[model samples]
Target: MPNLELLAPLAAALLAAGLFAGLLAGLLGVGGGIIMVPVLYYVFGLLGVDEAVRMHMSVGTSLAAMIPTSIRSALAHRKKGAVDEVMFRRWLPGIALGVLAGVLTAAFVKGPVLMTVFAVFALLVAVYMAFGKDSWRVASELPGRLGQTIMAFLIAAVSVMMGIGGGTFTVPTLTLFGYPIHKAVGTAAAIGVLIAIPGAIGFILGGLGEPGRPWGSLGFANVVGVLALIPTTLLAAPWGVALAHRLERRWLRLAFAFFLAATGIKMALSLLGA
Candidate 1:
């Protein structure tokens, strides 16, 4: 039997993380997986989980947790007609291929290296979110098929390694290409569902039979973590969607940028032993 006593604290922390993750999913199209990875990693460490697989477990479990939240957020956004169907279709094939590659990358890359990359990337995106003008555009339209495939691949792959749902990359990339922020956020929410599904499956397969995982883990995903996070995340996500619709686009972007900057800085500081 699992030890409920030891699990209580982890459950508490997971619930809190879920709340934030859900809100961000709706508000900024981020699946909250980015934040959840670090939280799960720390709590798992305190639980005596093995260091070798701790990051893997964190990434996998976070991907699993994101499934429901992203779905919920997507549905809420769709109801408001914020989702851009044309862009979603154009982006789907590449997103699929990229998700597969990303899952594979996560299997081989070292955790610290991935974290550093994530931190640098987040900071860069944050800068754009904070200051990029509406007129800024790489082109008058999104790239042609080949270029889009590569960009989509990179977005999905990087997001998987970082335990995110690809929104962190997608939203800014879309906005940079002249898509409206609201449309970018909503479309990204739907795309997150795709990223999380395959990413979760890949992690589960990758971690099969691996030792030193937490109790109740199926591969790297912990049943307790998924369960504890889901309810609150489902509850909070709709609230965030409503609020995001109410807020001005500029304010929403600024708030999201601030949050990303803080998360990235905190991760970078961890590398310096801070």
Candidate 2:
């Protein structure tokens, strides 16, 4: 077990991160998994866990927390006339299988490599979302089935590599393709559940099979970390939704872009040790 003092800061970080993630979700209509994954990785690294297993715990724990958070956000969005159920249904199968594949693959990758990959993705996405043409379009031109399937596959592949829930990629992709931003956000939130449920299970099963690793971890997921994160995120998620309902979305997108840039820079620096 980690020292109580260590756990305190971690607990505080989780709470703050949850609230922050909620605000980002509600305000930007994002799934919050993008921010949560990197934060988990940073916090876990600070706790002195073995580098090799850090990415697993970070990705798994983020998915665990996201299960409840996404549900809360999705419901909130559904209430507001966002979240396209039709799109969600179409994407389920691809999302389900892809997430499982990502988690299983992560169980075997090296930590530095994972971090570097995450950094690269974050850096690219941040740049694109902040400056890309499709950053916030009101209409998409892609066929519904093809777009959802492609996104599901992309989300699963990226989540495993970067510890995200595919929101950063999904929301923008959907919006660019013609879905309303709010609908895209809500749909993205629903996808988090698909990614989290299977991913969390895979982490647990994988962790159990690893012979020697840091104590207090269940597979690649840390029991301690998951337990610490759940409540605060659940509570904050709805609050974020309420806030989202109140804010002007253009400003919110700007805020979301800024947050992504900050996270990307931090992750890049961590990988480069600068």
Candidate 3:
């Protein structure tokens, strides 16, 4: 068994992270993967986990932990009529396929590569969110069937790879096409469910029996981390959902943008050895 001394501190840290993640999930339509990924990676490092398996574990654990948070967040938005049901239903097929591709890619890729992918994409989305306007119209509306499917696939793939949900990419994409930000955020929360379920499974299978895993690991997902995260996230998510509904759209956009930019830059710099 792992030392209780170490596990105790780790558990405390994860609980704190979970609370913050819950807020983001409900308020910003994320699955909390963005926050969890880096936090897990760092915690795993302290546990002396191998570099090879550390990042993958972080991603897997984040995905697994995100499931309930996403569900709760999505349901809250659904109740508010902010979710776009038609779009969400149409995107399901593409999202599942994308999750498969993304998980496969993550399984084979290096830790730094995954970090870079997450960092660069996050920066790009943050830029768009910061400067882009509500009047922006990429195609005067969301695309037709083929385009929507393709975009959905791309969004899911990127989100899974980055250990994020649809919010990091989807919200901006929808806004560019003239969808209201609230609707985009709500829809993204639902899409996160589609990505995380299969994606977590893939990570588990991929990392099963891999060397240098931490204590309480079932494949790449850490049981302690997952368990520690869930309850706090569940408790705090409703508060964020309530906040989301009351906040102005512009403020919401700015808050999300700033958070992404700071997190993305820090991750990118750390990866680059700066």
Candidate 4:
């Protein structure tokens, strides 16, 4: 067991991260994995976890926590009749396959490479959120079956690599294909479940018996982080959904955009040894 003095601050930090993650999920229709991954990375680093496994552990733990958070966010959106069931079902198989492929790939990739991938993707997401117009459309409707399959695979693979649920990619893709913002958000929440479950399992199996993992780890998944994050995220997610229903969300997007941009820049700087 970890000493109480050390565990106390760690728990506190995790709780804070969970709170923010839950809110982001509810408010932005994101799975909060993007936020949680970076926070976990920093927390693990502070605790002196081996750098080799830190990013993997963070990614795995974030996905584990998202299992519940995504469900809660999805249910909240469903209550408002915002989810599109047909689209979700159509994309499921491709997403799951891609997630498995991603997990296998992540097992062999180094921490810095994964970090660089995340940083670049996050910066792109930030740029879109900050400046992309809501009225933009890439098509009159969602893609045909073949196109959707390809896109779904790509989205899941990239999401797993970045340790995010699919929203950062899914929402924008849906919207660009003319999905209503609310429906896109809700559907993304549902898709998060698809990405997280297998992704978490793959990470667990991939990292089994790895060296120098943090205490309370199972494979790459940090049990401590999952336990501290899940409950708070579940409780707070509904609150964000409530707010989402009642508020203008432009400013919230801007706020999260700035946060993501800063996080991306920090990770990029770290990668460049700046």
lDDT of each: 0.84, 0.72, 0.86, 0.90
Residue-wise C-alpha lDDT for candidate 4, range 58-171, written one tens digit per residue:
999999999999998998899899999998889987898889888988999999988988899999999998998889998989879878988899999999988889998999
- The digit string of per-residue lDDT tens for model 3 on 165-252 reads 7777787788889889789989998898888888888888998999999888898898888999999888888888898778765776
Clashing residue pairs in candidate 3 (N, C-alpha, C atoms within 3 angstroms): none
Candidate 1 stretches greater than 4 Å from native: 1-6, 129-135, 249-266, 269-274
Clash count list over all predictions? 0, 4, 0, 0
Better of 1 and 3 by lDDT: 3
User: Top model by TM-score, which number?
Assistant: 4
Model 2, 1-274: lDDT tens per residue?
6677987988788878877776666555555667777778778778877776777778777777777777787788888877788878888887877876787677777777777777778777777756765455655475667766876887777775665667777777777777666677777777777776777777777777664345577777776777777777777777777765566565555666677778778867877889
Cα deviation at 140, candidate 1, in Å, is 3.2
Q: What global local distance difference test value does model 4 have? A: 0.90
Candidate 3 deviant stretches above 4 angstroms = 249-259
- Candidate numbers, best lDDT first, in rank order: 4, 3, 1, 2
Q: Which residue pairs in candidate 1 collide?
A: none
